[model samples]
Target: MDHEKVNILLVDDQPAKLLAYEVILKDLGENLVIASSGREALEVLLKTEIAVILVDVCMPELDGFELAAMIREHPRFQKTAMIFISAIQVSDIDRLRGYEMGAVDYVPVPVVPEVLRAKIKVFAELYRKTRELERLNQELEDRVRARTAELENSTAKLRESEQRRSMAIAAGKMGSWDWDWISGDWMWDEGQYRIFGVNPESFEVNPANVQALLHPDDVDQLRKAIAEFNKGARAYETEFRIIRPDGEVRWCVGTAAATVDDSSRVVRVSGVTVDITERKRAEERQNLLAREVDHRAKNALALAQSIVRLTRADEVKAYVNAVEGRINALARVHTILSLSSWQGAELSKLIDEELAPYSLGDQIVLAGPEVQLLPATAQTLALALHELFTNSAKYGALSTRSGRLTIGWQVEDQLLTLSWEESGGPLVMTPKSRGFGTRSLLASVESQLGGQAQFDWRAEGLLCRLQVPLTRKTATTTATGKFEDASSAELQRASG
Candidate 1:
């Protein structure tokens, strides 16, 4: 039901044709981007997101088939709908060729406006649905991660409280009481009075008084245990709750032994009544934590399953490598989150870890103010960084000596903007085809983080800019690392 206008790119060499296409599509109420050539279209794609592409098949520099081939190579555009238009197309062979190059539909020169609109509408709507699905999946993943973090924190706190209670129990004394059956007299130690919340000066130490202090729910159970002891059970141990005078409930463990003469006639009963309230509470918390841990494990396994299912690769080896790399990125982020108890992770630390394998001392420069990323942000961004670093090491600045990579970020207006620039490597050239790595980089920043990513393939190197929206609480005012001012301008100057 919810929707937004999507971009539709129209590429043709003729200005008249471009105008005509625009006029026809303007009624669709979508943003139309015009390009005169395939190269121009590529430039537009690098800067903007085009949901459906309408390209003429007979351009001079790059024909429609060639252009589609190039576009299909890029993971980001692999699923993009491409409609090819040609003035002279009647052969089935040509149509087959177009389809092979990722063309969704082929339109002949004397195009029917109605047919064109209908076809484009279907593809456009499909694109919107696909993106919506992706956004929903991302939201689900983020929620699961946040919930897991909360459960983990609660589990940790419970464990700490349990440990403290255990220590106290070990060091504290137990309440002891002795009852002389023949004399009908009861004697209690100070510990017993304290455990039962009895006032030594006002409360009598008697069996009736003790029974009255028992919790209503626990009274019947205690009576049953005492009856068992009276029926020739020499030793007895039972746990029951006691209500203090002020109405506070506490758990207590009472253990007693009956002393009998040679005739097996009981003479007295002596028992120790210890306050085990903390221990009981600790056990309850431990059970809750166990259930939470099971839940967390399932969430994690589900996330891993999603990753495995969605990952794309051409061959088994490539698929394995890609999946392994992504899993490793998640694991690394998990470690970082664990260190902070899943509150978040440092941005600079994430960058460092991803780049460590390819880092070459001074060739790499990192500058950023302290920024704590939420668990979801940290995870998605870490994978994006890993792909960037892996690509750089294989073909960009980090691939060669005398090359330099500068990474810098700053927080402003509740957004974290980062810049990555590479220089001094072999003459840089834009890949004729993009791959899974590039796709991942785009998806992480744009779809997952609700951000923007820009790529400028300069002759010298590649310059990438990423801007991710941040919550107000994630950024902190701290001294910039490795730079006097962490602004983008200063970073560029420093790199130079």
Candidate 2:
């Protein structure tokens, strides 16, 4: 026990008696406060924490009995022990009164100093022990509360960590399952329930139920894998298909390992299942695209052959050029198709690449907002642009050293208007012969783009205007108009 001083309050009306008692207990190894009256003792008690009170039974106004009664009435001082002292011998009735008023013992006055000091010492030691016990109890309670709080906090963190791990596994479309082979009991995580397309509570664990959900064509393969696992001849791993409750068939890859007992008999099995439906679908789509590409390549070669056969044999150079040009255009279309995975092509990029070979000093001017063209539209546009470039280089503006061409396009009211104008060329006239390239270009623009073309052969140069529907799958024609011709010198001097 920690030995701290205990406070004792001495109460008496006579100053001499108080001094005598104080002197006797001065070496008691405890603190003492002397009071001259019961009233003064009560005042002292209110200001300080007193462990024991020794009071004179005979005093003016309020005596020891009265003071003890008052002290007992207050909850704060209820535990303080009191001893009554008197010069006269205490009667049985008086003694009873003192005890009733919360006194523990009586002492006769003109008191034997040794007896008085010894009794006070005992009460002081008791008071010290009581306070020490109370402090220890409080400390114990504090430690218990802190430990309980730590346990609760740790439990909450563990639950949160488990929830996060479960959500991550579910997002990856993976499921975990456990089975007790001996008992024929099975349990599955939340993700496993989702993969089987059933509420966890509604499903029962049985071999028959599992087989019912598997695709009929894949059930035999799954059974074979399971049989091999049970025989200890192979590790469990298999890819199978399952028909869900919604009639949607999906593929799953399963891998499992078994737990054996002391005798090497399989006791349990645990495994994971991963959904592989998307992988299967992507592979199928890739095969279909390969076949389509092969067919399109053959058709393009046949079309090029037809173009060569129809052209005149006398104009061998022109015919050969036209055939090679058509084949090149088809090749460009195929390249774009491959780049876009056969989806489509950007119109601006397709036009840029086609005109690059014929550009004069790399001056093939291009002006338009970007647009994406469908696969069929891309092929037709490639052929048309190739023919235009071939014709211009052979007999039109591109044949002259001073000629310059401007190609511009705009989309307005769901219609695309593309124009090709030339200047600084030889005097122009309408061509007498309608060549294969010209006829093919006209057919491609009119039939495929659902638009019209107007050819203007002026004294200065040849200008062509094309109007096509901007909206796909629509065949709408709008009027074609040409801007007023500017002088060749003036047009050549203008900025591109």
Candidate 3:
């Protein structure tokens, strides 16, 4: 938002007062829209975007209080700050009336130019910030909408595969078969025959044939599990591939339970077989996707860190350190995500990781209700905190060993409000121009996290506050994208 684009409406019936207000506020570099009457002020407001309104309390018609009440009636000016200027002696009731009319402050005339400018400057800055946040939020929402559409299309394309899996489940248990231990006779249902690709009437099932159907690698394991069941340990369950009559192999799980006679002697064992090829395939596909996502994320981080290193050499080593440190802050989020098997990371853990090096035991205080973040939020917040920490370390409270920092957060209405404050260090100055880090920090909160941020550069130190939407991240990603070092993160990549 350009300074000159934000209009400050100066409303008064007297032309001299209007000119004087203009002269006093011209240096603020904002558009000063002067109106000689309340009607003219309304016209300008309708045609232009006004940030703050300075109105005289004693206008003849549509007076200051009345005009303010009218402005308040309009939704567009609901949040606009109102200031009243009056030369007459005012009573408590008069002041209360001005406030009730939505006046932020009332100035008894012979107003101090500095105080008036200071007040206007604050509102002007606020206007610019609010506009910027709206722009960023719109942009973020657009991206989210686009991404959601892409995901929906992708899911639609996979519908056929999912349907096949559903069919497999609905087809019922693999098949039923029964065995008589003493009689050495076996019976197989038609479902079992279809699974083995054999004609039910022509096929004869026996212990020897059942044994022959087992995959050689799984034969020993099945025998042990079933032997334990025979000794009354538990029901027997095993999954293995079996060669059909036509020499086609199929994956199936077999579960068996023995029936005992009145004398407590085992007479028959009934079992069921279910095909699990589709399920196993799905698991493999999922695992592959996990590996891909982890690979791409780490690779992106590495590329980012490399760019930071190449930004400067010895001449601007501090810049490199600052950038690299922030990248590491991002890496730490990835590290936490890895430790949790790619589930998610905790809020306090992210702050601790970023401030760990500079905290020096008790110099920093951390407090917040426990919260979990998905990978995207974790990464964005980690970087934001890194920038604040970098500034404090360079010029704020953390510059000295004795200075202190406090970090806290809470959630309300799906928004996570966090605060960072520092004390007992060198004096802080608010920068007139923001650099890449500063802009990037704002973007991390407003754009990436879909939240708002405010900074107070007090003489003692910097007090930074941010509100990010409390969102949950998913641990799933497509099996595509670039990789950094596959071998180094192999364990994490394959965690799924």
Candidate 4:
């Protein structure tokens, strides 16, 4: 968190309620800004960084709902908590409307002092942590820049043959070692031993010890480079993998040049070893990202071809429109995946994006706990949802003014059960044969997600149910080159 004291904003036209809120929160030892109306609250918000805003629902000129809507429009207050305090009875519809308007929580009048204080404290602490993480990230970036500058400056001096390279390596906290070719002697700095996971007491800088630490695949290349240098090559340079005592392999770049005396006779061969594991890993990640981009592009092209082959219509324009709609659905899910860093996205978000053009006022209903899906599964679900939604908009529930739709999900034993039920639409009847859209929906649910899909067509409406099993692959790789996945391991153990 930041070192500055926390600040909270209280908005209420009634001075008495504002004072009462202040009295309850005064013990928290924080700065409190009081505003009489929504306009004043906006002015205060623009001036100060407040963790949470406590606004009264029934304020003159501008109420809490209006104030919250205004605040949400500004990017600065996106993360700010908005709590609406109402003394009058708040009906279910009113409370839902308040939530729909961006109220984080509702604190009715005769507010419990402890409850209000607890809520304020929680938000304040969350804001503090967010600030703290940003600060640390900036600090880390600064350190990396400084160290990179030092390395670049040292590179110019590296042209000269001396122990200067070791000095630079040490300054950058890198491992380095020197070898004497004439005497067949090897010496390593403290950093070298640390990097190799070697015990100083038992480890020695010798051919035998070094060979044991070198990976079988890398030893031959390194030896060949050295042999070429011994055969009168001007310089010796090679990058190889070294297996640490703990069996962890690391990348190292070795640079060596033979130092000759006045007689032009080889006197000694000295070199510096610097770990390039992180740099190599970065290159590997870049290659992976490139491959992924290529893969996604090909996947898109293949999907377009499949859509074209499957779609059949009396007119070419109709075929084009059908294929275009499917492609648009794919692109919409791609956008969602990009926003989520390709990890996944919530099902509700995907639905909203697909149905943004249609009006879902009281007609479309969504009910489900937050469920995060894998990127592949999310894309499949998004496409299936788009087909169902488009069909509904065209000739189903959403076609009629009084028609209604209900979409809900339940999770049980790693299986997700989703239901899409439509009612109040015109009389429905089962189609004689499957259409392209129906086939695509079934393929997405059954083939793409490895699940079961069912469709029920009744005179009243259509009901679709999908059942998919969730897989746990919660392993995350850390910066320090370690993989940890408790969930995956636990699942494996249970299955075994």
> Which residue segments of model 2 deviate by more than 4 Å?
1-5, 13-33, 36-48, 60-62, 91-100, 110-126, 215-240, 253-276, 279-341, 344-377, 396-496
Using TM-score as the yardstick, the better of models 2 and 3 is 2
TM-score of each: 0.47, 0.59, 0.41, 0.59
For model 4, give the 10-residue run with minimal summed lDDT. 487-496
RMSD of each: 47.8, 11.8, 45.0, 39.7
Question: For model 1, how big is the CA root-mean-square deviation?
Answer: 47.8
lDDT tens readout by residue for model 3, 135-228: 9999999999999999998898689676664556448635777888679788877677777777777767875676687777777866796587
Any runs in candidate 1 off by more than 4 Å, and if so which? 1-172, 180-185, 197-199, 206-217, 230-232, 243-250, 259-267, 277-305, 337-344, 372-377, 394-405, 409-496
Expressed as tens digits, the lDDT of each residue in 1-496 for candidate 4 is: 3356688999989888889999999988789999998998899888898888888999888888888888999999877888899999999999998988888888887899999999988887788788888899999999999999899888756755346655666665477566776788987777788777898778877887888889898889768867876677757888888998777989888777777768666667776677888899999999888866776666666666666666667898977877788778888888888987788888788878877878678898889988888876776777688889878888899999989999999888988899999999988989998776777777666655668889999788999999987783433566975443232222222222
CA-lDDT, candidates in order: 0.81, 0.78, 0.78, 0.80
Return whichever of 1 and 4 wins on TM-score: 4
lDDT of 2 by residue, 309-361 (tens): 55454676866776677778888887988899877887787877777786577
lDDT ranking from best candidate downward: 1, 4, 2, 3
Q: What is the lDDT of candidate 2?
A: 0.78
Task: Give the Cα RMSD of candidate 4.
Answer: 39.7
Which residue pairs in candidate 4 collide? none
Taking the tens digit of each residue's C-alpha lDDT, what string does model 1 give over 382-430?
8778878877887888999888999999999879999999999988888
Runs of candidate 4 exceeding 4 Å displacement:
1-167, 171-176, 199-202, 472-496
TM-score of 4: 0.59
Best by lDDT: 1
